[model samples]
Target chain A: MKKLWISLTYLVFIVLLIIPLIRIFSGSWAEGWEGFVEALTRPQSLHALWMTTIIVVSVTLLNTIFGVMLALYLVRATWLGKRLKQLLNSLVDLPFAVSPVIGGLMIVLILGPNTIMGVFFEDIGFKVVYALPGMILATLFVTFPLMVREVMPVLQEIGTQQEEAASTLGAYSWYTFWKVTWPSIRWGVIYGVVLTVARSMGEFGAVLVVSGNIMNKTQTATTLVYQDVENFNVLAANSVALVLAAVSVGLLLLMEWAKKRKGH
Target chain B: MHIEVSNLNKHFGDFHAVRDVSFTIEKGRLIGLLGPSGGGKTSILRMLAGLESPTSGDIVFHGKKVNELPPQERGIGFVFQNYALFKHMTVYDNIAFGLKVKKQSKDQIRERVMSLVELTGLKGFEHRYPHQLSGGQRQRVAFARALAPEPQLLLLDEPFAAIDAKIRHELRTWLKDMIERLGITSIFVTHDQDEAIEVADEIMIINKGRLEQKGSPWDIYKNPQTQFVASFIGESTIVEDVSKLKGFEDASVWPGTKALIRPEYIEVGKRSEFRIASATEPGRVKHIHFRGSEWMVEVTVGDTTLITYRSLEKEVLQPGDEVSVLVHRAYLFNDNDSWIMENKLKEDPMPIHI
Candidate 1:
């Protein structure tokens, strides 16, 4: 009975996953290579894709490093900063709880020429609002928690024993970190980075608020998709949405693969 | 290779984990730092290895102050209770890690690791990760790793705790041979008195962040200085009436005192010689546990059940024999025993770590 139930579950999973890919494959069948070529060569469409890739890659790299550092700091540090660390750790879900538009607005309010950061940056001939930096800030805010969430528990569970053992064995702190500590957390960090990339790719609301949706440079894939729909270009919007979906599905699958390899 | 821990202290928030623990260990000695759980054995080892800082004192290794040094800078190898092997690395890499960190020549590292692995009976298992090894095998790997570095001092934090009972004795004997062969000053932390007796040159019984006694294992076993040491090191039947021993003038015997006796030392004799209130019964023997040399006999002493092990060569008492047990070489400790007062531990001996 248990075997029968397991087989049935797998059968259902295959159907659920394969059905969508089949629809996607079948949907693009009529359009073929000509549509694919057109989608790739079109300047506005292709440039938007390039911008999206850049935003996702840059924002994700920044978030992964900072997130891991934050996790290490929170776990290892003993000071008056602990209460603050707890508050910051819980701040990961701030994006999920608050609307993305509000997060964007808060950045604008705090650093948009009228606020102290904005006023200070203005004096230095820099701007956060209506700029690429602003877009990064939005993505960073949304994705900050991903890597930390992945890495912290692994660090906690695997613990300082191996690291301390390494240290006592004559490896300096940094050597112990890379040699003993990093291997255990590397998979978790990769999963986090992959998630951050996917989330940044489809990040729309806050980037829309901050980017001002500049047609060629600042507009990201999700923002461009929104722009296309608003401009009554439904097919173009569908194309970009499908691309985002494809990337997300591909990376999520990569995460699953890494997880399987680790499980073994 | 004398290692001295001077005024080493650690605090976890308001709780003082180790308080002013100080001990001097001579070279080529295997000392067991014995304590019950939460007695701060692990903390003291961590400080000695520089994994933790002494909140107030200094550690001197071979006449050099090492308190400010980080763990890696202190050429000491520590084995954790669970044997914290580098899981991602193969057994070869795990054993060679300490030497490699010191940038030993590759050939030297290989030779050292291979020899240790061979010694540990893990020769063919070099390529396997920690997960692929059994608990006993993992413990050997930990020992191999610690020994690979040729440390002046080796610290083992309850290395045999994770093994199954059947393997514990065998593994412990193997460890004793290895540590003895190395001739490195070593301190092992354990709460089990049997393990300490089997392996250590000296045993220091700790209770509530204080050392109760530091002496040869035999000194501790035969003449436990404190009640805390007596109970923690071995199973003892302590009678509060020890101060009322036949001799009253001895300074060793004090008022409100107790006599702690290990059951094995108690010899059964006739009713005429029995001092404590006693009773005898005739009933079918329910059970006996076979301990290689002796058989632990369980019999009814009236309403209460008592256990006493006699030589296996001695005639096995039949199901319905009336027998008497005698108390010999019982330890006397000052009584007025209260756990709260015991923890207060006034004028306690300083902790010593080698």
Candidate 2:
């Protein structure tokens, strides 16, 4: 009975994962290596890839800093009242609850060029909507919870005893955090960063809505793939997706390594 | 450094953890905050270490008020329960953390850390992480780490609670000797009565967030001022209506009082062996426990059960056997105060004959 169940699971996994991955890998090289190179070297394709890299780097950095800070505040800040902490804690999972498309729409509505804050920013000579900033913001919205969720449990697990021990040893708060707290949570932060990077790389609905899928100005890798699919350019879309899938697989491996280190 | 705390109170929301606790410690004295769990002994220790602020009180060290001072400025060494060693850093780095934070030169840090490592008996294990070391080794590293910065005082919260029984006993003696040799005023919190009595120069008993008593172990054992102290300080059984027991008939004058009988105060022996057999009450052995070095025999005289320890040199006692039990002393206490009551038969060992 157990063998039958195990075989059933393997069948489902191969059908759902291995088959699709193989199809994409073969589809990307339908025109051979020269055609694949040609598809990826187009100015629009290169720009989209570059934009994705910029978004991934910016989002990962911002998310790591802010997410870790928020997790620490939620777990360690005694000044926050119980109700307020609970409210803020639930608010952290908002990105996971709301659809990314709706998240992008909310940002556009709140910070679009016609809005008061948007016009004020434009008056100061900074473009937000349908630009690099908006694309980054959209990806940030979808990936914010990934880092926080990964780091929050780690912060909670380490507790405040070591920090207290450090303080009583004549170390200041900042020194205690860097010496005692940072080393303990670094693995968790690394895991969070990997998740955030992967999420930002593959973010599609939000970035498309916010970036307006501009060919060179703000189009990201996933958005360019969407545009190609919409225009019946299956080969181009497959080529870009193959790159995303490869990076995601690498991040998965990195995440597993981080998880093992954190177990120690 | 001499330390004084006055009217210290701590409240976690509506729950009062420490209430009106006041005490003073002389310089170089090793004090023990001894109490049951959740009795606020740790709260008092943390407040002294500046880890927790008192709700309303003043902590004065060397005649300087430090209620507003942070733990870093207070210059205290705190050893947490379970050691709380830095798992990531090697033993050497863990000990050098405070020195590095104080901006000591690398040479000075190395010099201090090496000496501490030697003092703590962790000489060869400097490069191992906390997880790689045993519980006792980790505790020593915590001690060395705390001592590296040369703090004015030291605080340990349940220092031996995480170690095994044998190691705990060894560490207790080692810690007591080390603290005395260094002449560093230290305070440790422990729920184990044996640990506190055996190691502390003075033990402060805490109960229900209040300071019950503070004295030398022997002094507290001989003279317990409060009912709580009388019952808490040793292995005792609280017996009501003490006047019902033989030789305690005069105790009836203190109505509504309870008597605490410690095992050492009661002697159980064979009827033929006791010289004062007339004064000794006949009791039935209800249960016998084989302690490592002694036999703990429980005897029931009339309706009351009394506990007494018997020597292994004497004839073995068995359950359901008839024996003569003579209680030399028992502490009688009411709600507010306590006093010792001696067996009146002891005054007249030989009875008058007609």
Candidate closest to the true structure, highest TM-score: 2
DockQ for every model comes to 0.76, 0.80
* Interface RMSD after interface superposition, each candidate: 0.9, 0.8
Local accuracy by lDDT, each model: 0.78, 0.91
Candidate 2 versus the native: TM-score? 0.95
Query: Residues A1-264, candidate 1, lDDT per residue (tens digit)?
Result: 999999999999889987766654555444776765565456777888888878888998898788888888777666647678878778766887888888888888888868888989988988888888888898888888788888898888888788878888888778878898888888888888888888888888888888888887777778877887799765566666677778878998999987775553
User: Model 1, stretches more than 4 Å misplaced?
Assistant: A1-40, A79-82, B242-255, B270-307, B315-326, B335-354
Per-model TM-score (chain A alone): 0.85, 0.97
**In candidate 2 chain B, where is summed lDDT lowest over 10 consecutive residues?**
B344-353
Chain A TM-score (model 1) = 0.85
**Native RMSD of candidate 1 (Å):** 7.8
Best by lDDT: 2
Kindly report the docking quality category of candidate 1: medium
